[model samples]
Target chain A: MKMSFEHRDGLGLLRVEEPRIDASVAIQFKDRFHDLTQNGTGDVILDLSQVDFLDSSGLGALVGARKLLGAGRVLELCGLTPTVDRVMVLTRMHTVFPIHPDLVTALATRAATS
Target chain B: MTGPGPIPGVIGPRPWGLTLRFAATPVAVRAALSAVDAGLADAGAPDDLRARAQIALAEACNNIVEHAYPRHPPPTEAHIRLDIAADLGGLQITLRDRGRAMPDGPLPGRELPPLDPGDIAGLPEGGFGWAILRDMTRAISLSRRNGQNILRFRLPHADKPGPLSRIVT
Candidate 1:
């Protein structure tokens, strides 16, 4: 449940360093994500390029993170692997979060709009 | 450390498959998934099929760990037995556990949570497991007998010809 954060050009970038976010670490992931983004503002992009597997519990944690961010801020996701993307699509969670192909596209798109 | 292999004590005609038994805990479930994936890869299953199978299996096993074996009471040393058999037609899976039966003697509804983009906070955080299992699997069935719960399902191979022979078409 390791996460690294950086503020890149007005966008908060959070990278999930773990390879898998399953039931074993879902709670830790939610609590840690809250601690890191509690004071942040604006849209925060989560980079999941390193994650290979995410079960339902992990998906719940992602939703929990979004709730923790509140209404004003947004929790966007980028770089979902094949398996992770399938889970999102199957569960219809893709409709809720603004997903991007990669971090570069997310940053560029958000920068252009802002 | 339990890995993917055949259990000799079990009496049955097993052609091509692997069996693994692990403690019903989150950490053990995670490890069991990896082992199952490795076994599938060794059996030459395609990536797409393996990915979907893994997701469905994870949800099923997690249910057993979270619901069947209660945490507050600190359940006894309950274990889950997973049996997977792969052939040209598809992959068959059977999970057995001595834990408590499913709620009300049936599986949960497969309906996904309704998402309202306007109200982000109103969205659901859970209740997606049954939907995933239903979408990714075929011919799912559950039975409880003699204090044992046995869940079975099948994951059909892709229509494309690959390691697993394409039976449909």
Candidate 2:
């Protein structure tokens, strides 16, 4: 799994290019989360546009990232494929993290807020 | 006591058998499922049973990769073996892992909690695995032996209606 990170203004964008974010890839995801939070940037937008499939472990990684980001920080997800989106909905994680249709909207919302 | 208790289905002519070993990584789950799907097609298993088997196997393998080997380096190893009776009356699959032994506990059994209506819309992400296995398979067994945890599951043959009278009455 390869993750690219970029920061524009105050909003941080992390794009994951992994096809499957199931059990096997959870650790790598966790590691990336650790790297992202090391800077203490609190606000993040995860662009999952490239992820097609996700299971419980992937969900755990997202939830874990949210917890690590702390109260003031925010973690929003964008660009979920239908299958991945269904998994999120099935797990009810769709409610836990604010999800947007695309990265543009996600960043726009953050820009508007900040 | 002595040797490994006779490999599960050695008696008589074993109807169907499949053995595969793959890197204990997530990708292997998809590969394993594809192999199972192909094998079932060759064996002429019912479509529904094949689909269910694939889902169950994938979920079981995912659990092994995630829970058993959390945070481990890449290239760990796992093994899978499957046997299906000719009569289609029984299907057995075994998954073995060399990672840390899983916590010994009662095997997750049937009896799913009702899917709450409100919660259904935003299903909790984490706990769906065991539920999927419980719903899909007839029997599930887990054990730790020889420094490895082996999980096995079985599905009974589909029941056929005995007669028109039995079905109607």
Candidate 3:
């Protein structure tokens, strides 16, 4: 699970650098995502522009990461690749997390609120 | 896929068909899928079939790894055979395993998760795999034959992918 993280004050962003998120990296993705965003405040946008494919395990990991974040912090998603975005919508995961078309929109939502 | 070639392991050669076996481990998932994609590429399989098969087969193979050898009894091996038809009209994949059968004897006919938008508690975390297999592939069948769990499916599509809703699948 190749990834890079950027944090400023309480706002944080995690960009996943992988083409496919399947069973092989599902668990790793969840653990690393949670560990990276565990200390953040406000909103954390997960960028998945590079992910072309995602499976059930990856979905589960995302959902689990959301749950692990508890209720205070927001684990929003942004920049979902078309293929990855489709799976998220198909599973109604878009219902669970606020999905933005890109990072700018995700940050804009945060700005509008705060 | 010139004329069925010869049956696997028979008299002559089987140039168009390929079979592979893997240990029932998560690592085998990538290896098996990459090999199948390469094989399909060699046979000129369309992107649609190649795309769907990638997901469906992942679910199938992962199912084998997760369910075949639960936790107590240890794991076994899984087999995959990719066969292109005589005229190259379509492709067939047969996945074989020596492990346990599906809990319900066959995969359940599950639909996409219900449309519940607001309620986090009502949101689903899993159970989308089999639905993906059913929606992506044209035909799918699972059975137990001679103490071997056999799952064979077909990808007969020749066009581009469908709309975003199908992508959700």
Q: Estimate each model's TM-score.
A: 0.89, 0.58, 0.81
Which 10-residue span in candidate 3 chain B carries the lowest summed lDDT?
B3-12
Would you list the rank order by DockQ, best first? 1, 3, 2
Q: Write the per-residue lDDT of candidate 1 for residues B41-85, one digit (tens) a residue.
A: 655566887787789899999988888887753365699999987
Q: lDDT of candidate 2? A: 0.66
Instruction: Return whichever of 1 and 2 wins on TM-score.
Output: 1
Q: Candidate 2 — which residues are off by over 4 angstroms?
A: A40-42, A111-114, B1-19, B23-27, B30-56, B65-78, B82-106, B109-128, B132-169
Question: Worst ten-residue run, lDDT, model 2 chain A?
Answer: A86-95
What RMSD does each model have against the real structure?
5.9, 10.4, 5.4
lDDT of 1 at A66: 90
Provide interface RMSD per model, one decimal.
6.0, 9.8, 3.0
Report the lDDT tens digits of candidate 3 across residue range B108-164.
Answer: 654766656455445567788876666556567878888788887766545334343
Candidate 3 Cα deviation (angstroms), residue B42: 4.6
TM-score of candidate 2 to 2 decimals: 0.58
Best by lDDT: 1
Candidate 1 chain A lDDT trough over 10 residues, lowest sum:
A86-95
**Candidate 3 local Cα displacement, residue A88, angstroms:** 2.0
Better of 1 and 2 by lDDT: 1
lDDT of each: 0.82, 0.66, 0.71
